[model samples]
Target: MITIAVDAMGGDYGPQITISGALKCLEMVPDLRLILVGDQEQILPLIPHNLSSFVEVVHTDQWVAMDDKPSKALRGLPNSSMKLAAQCVAEGKADALVSAGNTGALMAISRHVLQTLPGIDRPAIMARLPVREGATYMLDLGANVDCQAEHLYQFAVMGTAFAAANGHVVQPKVALLNVGVESIKGNQQVRLASHQIAQCDALNFIGFVEGNELFSGKADVIVCDGFVGNVALKASESVMRLAVDKIQKRLSVWWLKWLGLFLKPILKGLARELDPTYLNGALLVGLNGIVVKSHGASDEQGFSNAIMQAYREVSNKSNDHFEAIMDQIEF
Candidate 1:
């Protein structure tokens, strides 16, 4: 059974959404076991008595608040739910961890507790975004604001390995997120990183990509600093919502209403593809342990999706698998 540690008191709904989602995931994956870390008083009552065999609860007195600063959580609360969940992985009690907690706190405590993988200076948040070719892996989604060219190289290598391991792509094209495809378009950092990546035989670096090509499937791995990546991610999501609303309103017309009904299956497929909850986990890649971050406001479907992601990573020993590939690349 794949063991997954879950911060049950992390998200907005805490035990309500997380514990429910854990139970739902257990029902889906019979070989999966979960360690739900939270306050006993808040979590125990929610779990069904019969599930005590598969689902274990670890009680902690503190929880990292949604607004708690990373430094404060790291310095003040050593035994928070988030910390204990991460500790399970550090101590080998759990194979992977999932949390819908304070993103900064999760990152900070995870780094402090688990440390970074060999030769990695920092961790980057990588998420699979829907694209023409199914999905593209984008990294540094609000993890590191200020990054060096070497950091981008690490993201490139790790992102490439991730695409191959999970996305089932061979020689996944890696690109530097820049103003244009030309080397002259971006700032010094991107241009320098591009040249270095091109020199590294381990990574399949494909020069630069513009923001517009983000979802065009031009590159399987898109590398950028957290500021640009976070903004672009949010903007694309906003645009997706706007486009969906407009399409729905347009289809509601008297003549098109029947056509829309006839294409309901196709529409539902599109909705699933675009649904954020369907692909809710973000990898804290470069950390020593496998850590997945669920959206703080995620519901059962989304939180469970995150847990499933942890399960897959644990089942495949993805972190160790990727590390083998990473060993080939020199940053």
Candidate 2:
């Protein structure tokens, strides 16, 4: 059975949303067990009696706030739910850790507790973005802002490993996110990283991918520094929201409302494809243990998706695969 440790007191809604999400995950994943770390008083009432056996509650009243500084939260909050959840994975009590807490704090505490794998200098945040065929995985999302060429190369290796582990793609196509496709287009770091990634025969380096091509299904894995990646991701999400809002406003018209009824099915499918809930989990790859970070503002359903993601990673034995891939490389 796969066991996941959850920070049940983290995120915007606290235990109310997290505990409910944990229950939802249990319903979907039959062989999964959960360790909900949070205040017992708040978490207990949310859990049902029948599902009690499948979950273990680890009580803690403390939790890292969404705005907490990474360093402060790491040095203090010794018993915070996020820290304890990470510890559960590091100590082998759980197969993975899932949290919808402060991203910086989660990374800080997770790195401190679990450390990075042998070949990894620092862990990168990898998450899936909607693509025409399916979804493409991208990395270094808000982790290491000022990254070296070697860091980007490491992100490529880790991102490729992650995409392959999903069982959907074989020898996933990798591309460095750049201003343009030309070799002379990108800055020094990207150019160097591209050359480094090309040296690995195991990686399918397909040249550079620009911002507009993110959802074009041209590349299976896109690697960039955290600053660029984070900005691109947020901008894309904003664009999606803007388009949705405009469509909704247009559909509110008397004539367009009638047309909306006819297009309801198609729109629902489109919504599913673009929904952030479906793409809620982001894995902190290159860490010694699995750690899935859910968006802090995500709802119950979104949090459930994050838990399921962690379960999938555990079942896939992603860390082992990643380590093996790294072992084949000289640097």
Candidate 3:
């Protein structure tokens, strides 16, 4: 069975939603085992007796709050739910960890406990984005705001490994997000990172990609500093929401309402594809162990998706593949 430790008190709704999500995930993956780490008083009451066989609870009264500083959590809250969850993975009690907690604290605690993989300078947050062809993965979503060319190159390597591990992609095209597609368009950092990626035969660098082409499916892996990636992600999600709202309003008209019946299937598919909740989990790549971070405001469905993402990584033996790829690259 694939075992995962979850921070049962880490999200906006704490055990109310985390427990629900864990139970929902149990229904989806039969061979999965979950260890819920949080206060017994809160987490135990939420779990149903029928599903108790597949879940184990590790009681802890403390948990990092949404506004807690990273440093404080790293040093002060050693027994917090988030920290204990990471410890489960680090100590080999569980194969992975899933949390929808404070992003900064999660990063700090995971890095300190699990540490970075061999040859990796730092860890990065990689999230999936829906594209025209299928889905594309981007890294450094909000981990490191400033990065060097080497760091970008490492992100590309990690991204390439991630795409290939999905078992569908072959030699995924890697690109640097820039102002324009032209080589001379971006700042010195982008140009230098592009050059570095081009030299690595292991990666399939496809030159620079503009913001407009983010969802155009031109590249399977997009690498940028955390600042750019985070902004682009939030902006793209807003645009998707706006588009869906406009379509709903347009269909509310008397004439369009009649036609909406025939277009119901198509609209349903579009809404599913556009919903950010469907792609909520963000993997903290380059770490020695698997740690998937769900959005803090995620509901039951979103948190369940995060758990499943961690399961997939473990089943695919993704960390072994990532280490192999990293070993092949120098600097």
- How does each model score on lDDT? 0.86, 0.87, 0.87
User: For each candidate, what TM-score against the reference?
Assistant: 0.94, 0.94, 0.93
Which residue pairs collide in model 1, if any? none
Model 2, 238: alpha-carbon shift in Å?
Answer: 1.3
Q: Write the per-residue lDDT of candidate 3 for residues 197-233, one digit (tens) a residue.
A: 9998888999999888887888899999999998888
What does candidate 2 score on TM? 0.94
User: Model 3: number of clashes?
Assistant: 0
Measured with C-alpha atoms, the lDDT of residue 154 in candidate 3 is 86
- Predict model 2's lDDT versus the native: 0.87
**lDDT string, candidate 2, 156-205, tens digits:** 88888777777668889999999999999989999999999999888999
Kindly list the per-residue Cα lDDT of model 1 for residues 72-104, writing each as its tens digit: 999899889999999999999999989999888
Top-down lDDT ranking: 3, 2, 1
